[model samples]
Target: MTEQKRYAILPLIAIGLVGGLLSGLFGIGGGVIIVPALVLLLVMPQRLAAGTSVAAILPAAVVGAISYAVQGNVDWTAGILLAVGIVIGSQVGALLLSKLPVGFLQWLFLGFLLVVIVSLWFVVPQRDSEISITVLTGAMLAVTGFLTGILSGLIGVGGGIIVVPVLMFFFGANDLVAKGTSLVMMIPGSLSGTLANWRRKNVDLRAAAAVGLAASAASPLGTIIAGTLAPSMSNILFSIFLVLIFTQMLVRLIRAKKN
Candidate 1:
């Protein structure tokens, strides 16, 4: 590679490493970190940055999911139910995106996050023995996943941000289990999105490789830390994460309005 190209690769890897840590720690796809870092640090265009972020997310999801699964935190049936809903919801969401006003969607997403924060603080269920899934529980998970997928498609954010809270607060899952299940639910969605981006030639293969590999290496460490946190502490961390994501969306919306 040229000297300039070589220099560029290091920062991508660094961004991916940090993003992956956050992903494993929080059961996210790390697009929150990857997209902004690519735009600001690598001077990538927003569209391409988003596409590349999707590509990088796939490996991070896989690595993180495996770590969570190894700990017996993943609920496979729940994850599958959520994934099924995501597939349906995402198709509808993509169809709707072009017709919706960006500002409106941004406000809506912010509102959703606020509601989630309230639920996390006030409505989160007290810890008890792990709940076994029934038909109703599976249905609830599917509905929550569908809603999360719609928002993810419309806003270009990872569905995990929505999935984790719903799993915990609405479905009565413990924090670690919720996060792990969210990671499992994200795998197929991320892969599908990334593959579509690749087909469109939107993904930069070299950059994606550097980011994905770095994320894979760092994910286990983050998962380890997450596994060790208390349930209440994990909920606190997740609420803070939601607020941060909400603020970012608000800022981006304001910027778009200006231009």
Candidate 2:
């Protein structure tokens, strides 16, 4: 491999390992972590980072969904319906992103990341049982999916952060079920966003594939580990991860302000 390729591979593998663990534990797409890290560490351009992040998210979500499915945690109907909305919304969001300025996009993404970190830190808690999906709840789910799709298209995230909280808070889904459903919902949105980026020639397929494959291979292991943890232990670990992510974002924001 060329020096540049060799340089990229190590970071990609590191991203895959951390991303898979986060996906298994938090029901997030790992793009929130992966994209920023790529930009900072790999010197990847923003659009390329977004596209590559989406591409990598595909395998990670698939592996996570499968693991959750095995535990009988997936809600197929909800996932499919949410995915449909996500795909449509993502198309519109992608078009809008192309028109926006780079600075604007950066600030917007930072703001969104802040919101996610705050929500994860403050809102999510361990639930005792699954929530019943009522008519009102279904409508809310559709709305959340639409919003998440737009965000995903704009930022290259898989919308899992948004999906998980909504599932937990509004739908009363258990953590495992929320994680499974979020992964299932991500498939179509990620595909649509990735295709849009591909058309623009922004995707780095080699990097994406490498990271995706590694993340997929590691995800089941993370899920198995998650299953082994006690409820309190899992909660504690997840909280620590959230705190770490929040601190990273804060440092980024502070640096941006300084510069």
Candidate 3:
């Protein structure tokens, strides 16, 4: 490997170690962690970081989904619907990255994350609840996935930030089911977005591989931990995580403003 590539390896692994645990535990693609780490630590441009994060997310999403599936936490039918919508929507989101300004996307991302954090505090998580999908509910699920896919592509999140909350708050799914299904839906969306980003020359393959592999390796452990946590506890932990990230981003924005 080149000297520059070698230097990037350790950072990628460190970021992935934390991201993978979050991905498996929360059913997110861990892009929230990966993107910022890339942008703030590696000094990468926002769009490129977003694209690389999506690419790195795919493997972790797949592993996390499998871990949940094995425990029968996944709602396959709902997840499939979400996946179909996200696959198409992710392409559109990827297109937008090239068109929109980076500062706009960054502000938009932080705004959205703040909303998610607030919602998590108010929404009670169900551990044994399940989704009852009718035709209308199915349609809504698809729509949710479509919107989340756009966010994932644009913000480099795995779409779980919205999907998990929506499933729990709107669809009456338990936290485990929601998280598992979120991971399942992310697989296609992440794959589709990564390809689109790659075609646009936005992906950094070496970094993605380094992060993706490490995240995948660590996700199973997180899956096991998720199984042990109560739904209420999980929500609280996730909320705390979001709060820290929100603070980090806020500080970054202030620094940028000052500069």
lDDT of 3 by residue, 68-120 (tens): 99999999999999998899889999999888755666687778778878877
What tens digits encode model 2's per-residue C-alpha lDDT throughout 112-196? 5466555554554464557576787677677778888888877778888778757765777777777789999988888888888
Candidate 1 segments exceeding 4 Å error: 1-7, 91-101, 123-132
TM-score of each: 0.86, 0.85, 0.93
Candidate 1 weakest lDDT stretch, 10 residues: 1-10
- Candidate 1 lDDT tens digits, 174-212: 777777888888777766655555555455767877898
Most accurate candidate by TM-score: 3
Name the candidate, 2 or 3, with the larger lDDT value.
3
Worst window of 10 by summed lDDT in candidate 3: 1-10
lDDT (0 to 1) per candidate: 0.75, 0.77, 0.88
Candidate 2 Cα errors over 4 Å, as ranges:
1-7, 101-128
**What's the best-to-worst order under TM-score?**
3, 1, 2
